[model samples]
Target chain A: MAGGQERILRRRIKSVQATRKITKAMELIAASQIARSQARIAANRPYREGMQRIIREAASADPAAARKMLATPEKVDVAIVLVIVGDRGLSGPYNSSALRAGDRLVHMLQHQGTRVRLFTVGKKAPAFFRFRGLDVEQSFTGFADRPTFADARAVAAALAAPFVAGEVQQVLLVSTRFVSAGSQVVESEQLLPLVMPNDMEVAAPTGLKGYTEFEPEVEQLLTELAPRALESEIFSALLEGAASFHTSQQRAMAAATDNADELGQTLSRIMNRARQDSITTEIMEIVGGAEALRSGK
Target chain B: MASLRVEIVTPESALWTGDATGLMARSSEGQFTILPQHTATVGDVVPGVVRVATSSGEVAFCVHGGYFQVGPGEEPGVTRATVLAGIAERVGDIDVARASRAKETLEAQLASPGDLDDLSRAQLTGALARAELRLRAAQH
Candidate 1:
């Protein structure tokens, strides 16, 4: 019995060590992915900033005309909520947090007597909402970890059609915002009706910002620019979501690895104590048999 | 000075930045040239080659539809020209054979008698135009 118990303890230790190895590798992979995603986000910044500047210049060319297109309708009969989450989630609270925020937003919009249409990006959000008995109108997947501009365009196209068709009065986007390497927050922001970039979002270009000669009219220019701006915004958000996912994954994996280490240590200690107890029992048995022989003699 | 500060930027990187005597591009309205102190102009650039004439020499870029902006610079007479392209390739960097092949394939696809939806048709047209532009720039 003692030998059997020792063998079992040894196997358990081996299994724990194997699990620790996997966790350690996962932690490393997540760490490297975080770095790569962060670099991609940085590289994407220039184009996004440039696009914003152009849009701002055009929009300000004639604020009145731009406002006609940009204004959010007062009465929103139906709103579309786009929730972006990760496709594969082991990433801590990244997917769950975004889904929770989206859920709340949907509930709030419904409370206001607005019909909500749900569009989800990433594999997780659709199933999550469906599990909760909510219908997902559209779901896009397969590019959550590394989204391309084409992906953004596809998503924008979906969002644009409803707005253009006068079906969706408002469009809201929920995703994990990658503010910095150290911090990320799940938040929802309005996507449609083209918000004018405030001073905070973009630096006010100096001197004759819209001295631009519009090819046609400012209104036409704005009409053309809106979809491009939407694509850029979505692309940026996707990049941010990828970065945040990696960051959260790295942290979570690191914790798991650490926990595995602690558990392994505790198991080893327990196994050692068990072995010692088994050895003591064997020694006691041997001593009792010897005393029995002595008394019999 | 006739020289203008010309800059071409794509989503990936800044392709070119130099002082050029003139810059030429095509828009929906038609082809236009920009010289120093050209009225702060903004227009849409079509898929084509953007020619920049600099003191050093002439440089061309195959730009896939984007926005072009020109405004006054810090100097008294200098002007800044910014070309923001969705994708841009320097003339030297363009792969001529590949571009020609792409152009041919796109042309074939366009020629095929099929009922393509509006979006795919538009996408194919854009791709064909971009390929043709790249091929032209490469040949030039």
Candidate 2:
């Protein structure tokens, strides 16, 4: 190998060491954030489930009154899509997957002649869409990693505005859904006018006879409950996105740390071999010279 | 002949869960009460205080908005209501400065001329309103 090759190897080793230090620090930081994100997820679960159940029950109670809000999409003209992603990326495909999914959806909608008005959450969405020449109607970043309910409400409001103004026919939410520590899937959900969850889940696993009467009529209840339902769903989605973001970062950092370690080991091995070769050459020369001197004497 | 089981769950945590003698909640129609063996009723919970009487004592919680379901059957009294944002405890537990900070941010947003959109401003107002109520309740 050229002498410069050893110098380059030394430089690479140093670089890897620095990268390892950074990755190790990031890994620890993300690992700590995971617990908080998990806790936030856990804390919000009861509310979302309860909201879902209430919406289901309320819809079942008055199917006629709920018809306007709980609509099955027949045609789409203008769709407002909300994409939830992280502001910063080092998290492997966490940002890319969401960005790609959103792009695909936008393209699909445009192909169908549907006007796509996009509202992006997280820092990455704006840049991603801009790169592809897609216009983002609104973008909110810095809240994906540690989102609060207020953030969700802000997003929900933005989605609902176009629907309320008749500018958009349907509202869709694009987000990463966290299934488990090791599994997360990006999905696009309808987020406007508050559609009812499936009947199968709402019928209360225990089918005991039940009758619930409302005093002010079902429409009024729907009016109040529908908005809250949307808020809950959005909050839950944010929580999932946050959990997924942290998990992805932790995993990516760990892989980086491992690669740095492997590279470090390889460099050390090569250095050791080089040192051995030089020592052997020196010993051989010494022996040859000693033999020559002995013979000459 | 039986007691009512009441549950008030907030998004952050299950705020209140236990058996109750009677309780009155501000419903969409009006104020409604639930006692032992009350009629089965489900209605929208408005933004107000819910007073629940239990063995410990009568306690009240400020609920943003939600829905409740009460049974008509003789299955004792089962009433479950869940609110996404409610104060189970009082402002007593919250730090004065922190609560004021939340209030200040909300008030400032409300006063700002369209810095935030209408919906976010509304949410901020609502949160601040709730925080203010908590502070008031704590003083008493």
Candidate 3:
């Protein structure tokens, strides 16, 4: 029986080692992706900041016109919630945290008596929402790991059409924001009405107030800039989400690998003790048999 | 002496950034050029060639629809001009073969115009326009 126990322990240790190999490999891959995604975020910084600056300039030039497009609507009959998450699982709470935030946002909106249209950006979102009796209008998949500007454009188009057509008055986004390598926070914010820069974190210094000149005038420029600004915002959000996903995945896989190592060590120690016990039993049986033979002789 | 700093940036990356004598691009209003000491101007850049004249030579970029901002730079008398494009590339970097092939394919798709949805059709037209711009920019 002890020998059998030893064999079982050996098999389990082998399995743990195999799983550790997989986790270690995954950790390395995710680590590599973290750097690349971070670089992409850096590359996109200028464009995003420039777009924001231009918006700020236009918004400052004509506050009334800006209010028409940027102000929150008083009566919201319908709203769209866009949730971004990872395509794959096993990335710790990266996917679940965002999904839960989105779920809560949808519930809160429903409590206000507003009709909710749900749109998701990952393969894992639809099932989670549908199981809760929520209807998912559209789900974009297959590009969560590495998103392109085109992907962001597609998402922006989908979200903007209803807003432009007056079918939806508000657009809300729920996703993870990558603040740094060690910090990522799940945040929910408004996508439509363009969230004026003054309300944003890095409010422009408001230099040269009305001195900036607009070619076709500020009103028309802001109108044309709205959708482009939306695209830029979505693109940056997607980039941050990707970086967070990779970082979260790398940390999770590293933890899993450590757990496997601990499990393997514990299992092997038990197996060693079990083998020693089985050897002791065999030795005692031999001595007992020899003593009985000697007495019989 | 006054100086100009030009930056051509896209969502993916900054295509070009350097000191230049002049920046030339067409806005919806008309053809315009930004030189040192230019006034603060914000405008949309139509999809076409954007030229930057440096002291050594001139460089061209094939910019699909985007926006531009001309304002004062960090140091006094240094004008900063920033061009933000959703998609753009250096004219010299444009692939002629690929652009022509894409143009041909898009034209064929448009000619047939099967049950393509409104969104896809619009996207196709946009792509065609970019391809044509790239080809036209590369020609010169």
Candidate 4:
């Protein structure tokens, strides 16, 4: 019976080891992706900063025109919520955290008597939301791991249509912001009625403010610049989301590998003790048999 | 002494950046050139070739519709010119064969009798324009 128990333990240990191998491999792959995604984020910094600077310049030139676009709407009749998440699982809380935040935002908007429309970026989101009785208006898949500018452009175009058509007054985005390699947080922010960069974050104007000349005038330039700026924002968000996903997945897989190792150690210890007990029982029986033969003689 | 620093950047990466004598491109208003100590200007750059004149020679870039900003650099006597395009690449790096292929494909798509949404039609037209510009820039 003990031997049978030992056999079962051995089989379990082997299975654990096989799982460990998978987790270890996943950890290494995720680690490699982290560096690459970080590099992409670095590469995009120049364009993002440049776009922000141009926006600030245009906003300052004609405050009145900028106010119309930058000001938050007083009452939002219909709002679109966009959630960005990773397409794959095993990334720890990276996908769920953003999804939960988006869900909560929709609930809050609805509580205020505003209509809510949901849009998702990852394949993992639609199923999660649909199960909760929420209807997904649109879902874009297959690009969460590595997003291109064209992908961002498509997303922006879709989000902008409703806002431009006066059908939706507000657009909100929920995604993970890659603050640093060590830290990431899920945040929700307004995407439409463009949020103007605060004075603190924006670098001071090079020289005299309002001295910058606009080719087609500030009003026309701001109108044309809105969609492009949206694309830039969305692209940067996708990049950061990717980096955060890789980092989260690496941490999760490393933990899993450690857990597997501990489980294997505990099981082997139990198995070894079972073998010793069986050997002790056999030795006792042999001595008893020898004693009985001597007494009979 | 006054100097000019030019940076052509896209969403993916910075295409090029260096000290340059002048930057030339066409905007909605007209063609314009920025030299050292140029005034602060912010405007749109139509899809075309953006040329930068360095000491060695002129380098050309095929920039899709984008924006540019000319402003004072961090240091005094340095004017910084930045071009931010959604898509852009060095003219010399453009693959002429690929551009021509894309042009042909887009032309066929547009000419087909199949119904296309307004958004898709606009996107196809934009792609065709970009491919044609790339071909033209490579030729020059």
- Most accurate candidate by TM-score: 3
User: lDDT at A208 for candidate 1?
Assistant: 47
Model 2: DockQ against the native?
0.54
> Tens digits of per-residue lDDT for model 1 on A1-297?
767877888898899889889878988998989989988888777678777767777766676776756677899899999999999877899999999999999999999999999999999988899998889999999999988878988999999998988888888899999999899998888889877667522433552454568786777878888888888888889999999998998888888889888988988888888899999998999999999999999
lDDT of 3: 0.93
User: Which of the two, 1 or 3, has more lDDT?
Assistant: 3
The clash numbers for all candidates, in the given order, read 0, 1, 0, 0
Docking class of 1: medium
lDDT of each: 0.85, 0.78, 0.93, 0.93
Reference A-B contact fraction recovered by candidate 4: 0.87
lDDT of 3 by residue, A24-71 (tens): 999999999999999999999999989988888787777889888899
Instruction: Give the alpha carbon lDDT tens digit for every residue of B1-140 in model 4.
Output: 99999999999999999999999999999999999999899999999999999999999999988999999998999999999999999998999999999999999999998899988899999999999999999999
lDDT of 3 by residue, B1-140 (tens): 79999999999999999999999999999999999999999999999999999999999999998999998888988999999999999999999999999999999999994999987899899999999999999999
DockQ of each: 0.53, 0.54, 0.84, 0.84
lDDT of 2 at B83: 38
Ranking by TM-score: 3, 4, 1, 2
Give the per-residue lDDT digits (tens) of candidate 2, residues A80-151.
Answer: 888899988899999999989999999999999999998899988898899999999899988888988777
For each candidate, give its TM-score against the true structure.
0.91, 0.86, 0.97, 0.96
* TM (chain A), candidate 2: 0.90
